[model samples]
Target chain A: MKRRLPLIVVLVTAIVCMALKFLNLGERGTTLATDLDTIVQTSYLFAFLFGPIHLIRLHYSNVQKRRVNWAYSAFLVGVCAVCTVVFFINRIEGPVSTFIIDSITNATDSAIYAMLGFYVCSAAYRSFKLKNVEATILLIAAVILMLGQAPIGDAIIPNTSKFAQWILDVPNSAGMRGIRIGASIGAFAASIRVILGLERSWTGSGS
Target chain B: MDWKKLQWIDVRILYVIIVVCLLIPMFHPVGLPVAISDNTRLVYNTVESVPDGGVIWVSHDTGPGNAPELNPMIAALARQAFRKNCKIISTSLFNQTFGPVTTFEIIDEVAREMGKEYGVDWVHLGYRDNAWPATIRLMIENIIEGAINRDWKGEPLDQMPLMKQVKSIKDDVDLIFCTTVGSPGYADWMTYVSEPLHIPLTGGASLTMYSGVQPYIRSGQLKGFLGGLRGAAEYEQLVGVAGAGLAGMDAQSLGHMTVILFLVLGNIGYFAAKRAGKNQ
Candidate 1:
C-alpha cells in the first residue's frame, strides 16, 4: 500500500498535467493549470522544511557518534541552529540576519569558490600534456580558448576571439544540442516509466 | 637543466606565480580595450528596444559560485534599463539563501546610484521555491498570486506601486532578462513564458554554460546572451560604465596568459621527455 499509493498519485498527477499542457481546453484548462500550480507551489514550500530537518538530523547524529570529521558536522549543526533562531527572532531580511548572511555566509561561499581558480591553474599546468594526437588537439584547443577569452588573446593573436566564437557557435553548439535532445528524450522516457510505476527506485524500494 | 624537469615543478610554486600575476592587475590597472561581441550587442539592443518605462522581468537564477561572472550582467542591465526609464521586476530562483540576497544587493546598488525609487521604479520579488515551470507559469498568469502576494521582505506586493502596474508577465513584461547558472533559467523562461507569450528573452550565463545556450541564441529564443565575465565586460563597455567586469579583465587576461604559458611549457617538457625516451 505504501508504494502503490504514491505511484497512484504520481500517475494521476502526470496524466492531468499532460492533458492540461497538450489539450486545447481553453479557459477551463488554464484555470485547472493555475489551480494545480498553486498546489505545487504549496507543496514545494512545505518540502523546504525537509532539507533543514534532514540536515540537523544527520549532523546531530554525527556529533553524537563522534565520527570522523565530527567536529565539522558539530560546527555545521551549531551554525545552522544559531542562524535559524536568529532568523526567527529578527526575520530573514532584518539587519542582524542580513549581516550574518552578507558578512559570514557570502564571504565564506565566495572564498571557497575562489579556491577553484587556484586549483584550475594547477590542474591546467599538470594535466594539459601533449601525449598523443587527441591530447595534442585538446591542448591546442585549450590554449586557443584560454587566449580567446582574455583581452591579451586578441593583442597577441589577431582574430582569436572570432575563432573562439566559431568553435562555440559551430562545434560546441552542435554537440550541446545533440546532448540536450538526447537527454530530453531520455528524461521523457524516464518520466513515463515513473508515471507507469515501472521506475520504483525513487521510492527506495529499488527498480 | 633537464627539459623534463619543467613538468615536475612543485604545484605550490605555480600557485604563487598565478597569485602574483592575478594580483598585479588589481594594483596596477591595465585599462585594456574590450571588443564587444555580436551576442552582447544583441542583448544591449534588445533592452534598448523595450518601450520606454516597459517592465523587464529579471530572473537572476545564480548562486555565489557564478555570482562574480553573472552579477555584473545584472548591474549592467539595470544601468541600461534605468537609463531608458524601464521598470524592473526581479526574482532569484536559484537558491533561497544566496540568490535572493545577492540579486537584491546588486540591483539595489545600481538602483540607488541611479536615484530610482524602490517599489516604484523597481521591485524585487526575491527567491521563490524551486517549483520550476509551475511557479513561473503561475507568474505569467498573476505575479502577486504566484509569489504569494509578498515581496522579498515579506511585505505585501499590493503596497508596491510597480506591482500595481505589472500584474502578469504575459501581458505586462516587455522582456525577460535571466542571468542563469543552471536549470529553471533561460530554458524554463524560453519554453514556458517567452515562447508562449512572445516576449523576448535575453540575458547572460556563466561561461561554463555559454556553449549550451548557443543553440537557443541561434534559434532566436534568446535574443542574444552574454557569456561569463567577458560578456559582462563587453556589456559594461556598451553601457558606458566601468564596473567589476571591466576592473577584473586585466587580472583575467594575465591569468589566462599564465595558464597558456604553463601549458606550452608543460607540452615542451612532455615532448622532450618522449623524444629522449625513444632515443634511449
Candidate 2:
C-alpha cells in the first residue's frame, strides 16, 4: 500500500491530465485533472503539516531513550509552535506571513543561486589544462565567448570583440540550434511514447 | 599503459586556475561590444513597435536560481515596455523560487517610480503547480476557469482591473515573453503556450540551458532568445543600458577565459606526463 497506492494515484492523474489537454470529453476530464492537480498540490502542503509530527515523534522517542541533544526537543517544539501559530495567524493574508514566507523563500533561492559562482570557479579551473584537442577548442571558444560577451573585452582587444560577436551570433547560434533540434526530436519521441503507452516513466510502474 | 595512466592530472590544480580566472572578470569587466542578435533585437523591437500603453503578457517560467541571466533581459525588456507605456500582465509557473516575485517586485518598483498604478497597468498571477498541463488546459479554456488563479493572494482575480482585459491566455495579451531557466522548463511553454497560440515568445536563459533551447528560436517556434547572462548582457548593451548582467560580465568573461587556460594547461600536463613515461 505504501508504494502502490501513490503509483495508482499518479497514473490516474496523468491519464486524466492528458485527456483533458486535447479532448473536451465533457467537463469530466477537466474536473478530474484539476482535482488531481489540487490533490498533488495539497500533498506538498501536507509535508509542512507532517513535518512537525515526524520531528516530534522521533525526538520524543529519543528523549525517552535519553539520547544526546534530547533536551533540545524543548527548543525545537518551542520554535515549531511559534512558527505554526505565526503561519495560521499571519496566513490571514497580512504582511506578517508574507514577510516570513518571502524572506525564507528568497533566502533559500539566493543561496542555491550563489552556488553558480563556485561551480564556474571550479569548472574554469579544470578546463584550463586543455586536456585534449577538444579541451583546447573548448578553451578557445570559452575565452572568445567570455571576452566577446562583455564590453570590457572590446575595451582590451577591440577586434576580438567583433570576432566574438560573430562566433556568438553565427556559430553559437548554429550549435545551439542543433542542440535545440535534438531536444525537440527527443521531446517528440517521448511524447509519442507516452501517447502510445510505451513510456510509463512518469507512471513509475503502470498506468 | 603506464604512460596513459600516469597522465591523469590532479583535479585541485584545475579548481585553483578556474578560481583565479573567475576573479579577473570580477575585478575588471572587459566591456566586450556585441551586435545584438536578430532574435534579441526583435524582442526589443517588438516592445518598441507595440502601441503605446498597450498590454503585453510577461510569462515568467523561471525561478531565482536562474535570475542572473533572466533578470537583466526582462529588466531591459520591461524598460522598453515601459517606454511605450505598455501594460504588463506578469504571470509565472515555477513559483517556488522568488524570481517571479522578485521580477514582479522590480516591475512594481519601476511602475511606482513612473506613477503607474497596480491593476491599472500590471497584474501578477503568482505561481501555479503543474505549469505545462495547466497552461495547456488554460489555452483551451478561459483562465477564469483555468488553474492560474489558484495561487493568488489578492481578492479573487476577477476584481483585479488588470485581469479585466484578459479572458484567457489566448486573449488580452499582446506578446508572451518567457524568461526561463532550464528544460522541462520552457519546453512546455513553447509547445503548449507559444506554438499552439502563435504568440510571439522570447527571453533570456542560463548558459547551461541555452544550447538546448536554440532550436525553438531557429524554427520561429520561439520569436527570440537571450541565451544566459551573455545574451542578457548583449540586450543590455543594445538598450544602452547597464544592470546586473553588465556588472557580472567581468565575472563571466574571466570565468570563461580561465576555463580555456585550464584546458590548455591540463592538456599540456597530460602530454608531458605521457612523454616522460615513454622516455622512462
Candidate 3:
C-alpha cells in the first residue's frame, strides 16, 4: 500500500500536469492547474527548512565525535548560530551579517575562485602534451580560443577573434546541441518510466 | 635543450609565475582596446529598445561566487535600464534570501547613483523558494499574490509603486535579462517563461557557462548572451561606464597569455623529448 499509493499519486499528478499543458479546459482548467502548482510551490518552501537542519546535524555529529578538525565544526556551529540569531532579530542586511557575507563569504569565495588561474596553468603545463594528432588539435584550438577571448588576441592577429567566434558559433554549437538532444531524449524516456511506475528506484527497496 | 627537466618543473613555480603575471596587470593596467562582439551588441540593442518606463524583469540567478564575472554586467544592465527610465522587477532563485537580496544591494548602489528610487523605479520581487518553472509559471499567471506578495523585507507589493501594474509577468514585462551561473536558470526562463509567453529573453552568464547559451542563441530562444567578464567589459564600454569588467580584462588578458605560454612550452617539451628519445 505504501509504495503503490505513492506510485499512483505520481502517475496521476504527472498525467494531470501534462494534460494541463495541452488541453484548454477553459477558466476552470487554468484555475485547477494554477492551484495545483501553488500547492507544489508551497511544498518546495518547506524543503528549505531541510538545508539548515542538515548542516546543523552534520556539524553537531562532528563536534560530538571530536572528529579531525572538530574545532572547525565548533566554529561552523558558532557562526551558524550567530547568523541565525542576527537574521531572525535584525534581518539579513544587518551590520554583522553584511560584514560576514561581504568580508568572509564573498572575499573567501573570490580568493578561492581566483586560485583557479594558478591551477589551470599548472594543469596545462603538466597535461597539454602533444604526443598525438588529437592532442595537437586540442592544443591549437585552446591557444586560438584563449587568444581570441582577450582583446590582445585580436590586436596580435587581426582576425583571430572572428575565427574564435566561428569555432564557438559553429563546431561548439553542433557538439552542444548533439549532447543536449541525447540528454533530452534520455530524460524523456526516464520521465516516462517514472510516470508509468517502472522507475522504482525512487521508491527505494522492496518496490 | 633538456626537455625532460622543463617538463618536470615544480607546480609551485608555475603558481608563482601566474601570480606575478596577474599582479603586474593589476598594478599597471594594459587598457587593451575592446571591440564589441555581435552577440554583446545584440544584448545591448535589446535592452536599449526597451521603451522608456517599460517594466523589465532581471532574474538574478547567480551568487557571490559569480559576482566577479557577472556583477559588472548586472551593474551595466541596471545602469542602462535605469537610464531608459525602465521599471525594474528583479528576482533571485537562490534560497530564502541571501544571493538575490545581496545582488540587489549591489544593484541598489547603482540605482542610488542613478537617482532611481527603490519600490518606485525598481522593485525586488525577492526570493521565491519554488522551483524555477513553478515560480515563473506563477509569475506569469498571478504574480501579484502567487509569487511576490511581499518584498524581500516583508513589505506588501501593493505599496510598491513600480509593481502597481505588474499583476502578471507575461502582461507587464518588456524583457528578461537573466544573469545566471547554472541550471534552473536561463533554461527554466527559456522553457517555461520566454518561449511560452513569447517574451524576448537575454542572458548574462559566466565565461564557463558561455557555451551553453550558444544553442539557445542559435535557436532564437535567447536574443543574446553576455559571455563572462569580456561580455561585461563590452557592455560597460557600450553603456559608457567603465566598470570592473573593463578594469579586470587587463589581468584576464595577461592571465590567458601566461596560460598560452605554458601550453606552448609544455607541448614543445613533450615533442622535443619524444624526438630526442627517437634519435638516441
Alpha carbon lDDT of each predicted model: 0.90, 0.67, 0.84
TM-score of each: 0.97, 0.74, 0.94
Residue runs of model 3 more than 4 Å from their true location after superposition: A58-79, B95-98
lDDT tens digits by residue: candidate 2, A14-89: 6766777778887676677667655656675687678779998887787788889878976677767777798778
Candidate 2, B61-90: lDDT as tens digits = 677677667778777877778767888877
- What TM-scores result for chain A when each predicted structure is judged separately against the true chain A? 0.95, 0.56, 0.91
| Interface RMSD for each of the candidates | 1.2, 4.8, 1.7
> Is candidate 1 or 3 superior in TM-score?
1
Best candidate per DockQ, number? 1
Clashing pairs in 1: none
Between candidates 1 and 3, which one is better according to DockQ?
A: 1
lDDT of 1: 0.90
Candidate 3 lDDT over residue span B199-228, tens digit each: 999969988888878988988889989998
lDDT of 1 by residue, A6-98 (tens): 999999999988998789999898888888888888888788888889989999999999999999999999999898899999998789998
